[model samples]
Target: MKAEQKFMMIFRFTPNFKYQPTEAEMVQMQEQWGGFIGNIAIQEKLISTYQLGFEGKQIAADLSVSEGILISENKTLGGNMVVKANSLEEATTMAKDCPILKMGGTVEIRTITPMGN
Candidate 1:
């Protein structure tokens, strides 16, 4: 039987604006999230994981130059993830453990299509 291929997974998260988690709370949250992803990794379902910073906070547009630049000195409000899976269903299933859901966050999963499609 042929082995299943992996694909890049991107998770879109919207934090609960009502409750802001402190640094310590964020650490705990990260631990739980890591544990969840680690479990999937053990099953050979996850290849990698990442937490993306808030979009707006990361990008700064220069009106004079009409260009966008990355600004690392800002506070981020949201996060994202990247994973590998055989199919969309698998990715969706792996996303079930995301801690953001408990705090009213949302997840968006999409497959990364290779080049030359």
Candidate 2:
């Protein structure tokens, strides 16, 4: 059996990003996202996925907390999904179909290292 590893894809997008699509367009995009994730689930690769809420707070190094604001175009973490794959390349290939990419968003793939006992 092939060794499998878990990866987390961190999604980021511009705070000003907006989708002003028609009803049909909206439906199409929704279907696309569903299809993309559904396929992975069928393959037993999808672990979990969820959309992040916009309202959040930020903590500074000094432990100062403030309302979360987009510090940069790619600073806001929009969402994330965890998946299992045989390799980083495979995980990256899987993330290529993420709907966020079409919205000018970014996905940062990182391996989920096992915790030391």
Q: What is the TM-score of each candidate against the true structure?
A: 0.61, 0.83
**Clashing pairs in model 1, backbone N/Cα/C closer than 3 A:** none
Residue 47 C-alpha lDDT in model 1: 64
Best model per lDDT: 2
Pairs clashing in candidate 2? none
Clashes of 2: 0
Model 2, position 36: C-alpha lDDT score: 85
Model 1 agreement with the true structure over 51-117: per-residue lDDT tens digits: 6543432232663332332323332235455566667787788788777778665676776767895
What is the lDDT of every predicted structure here? 0.63, 0.88
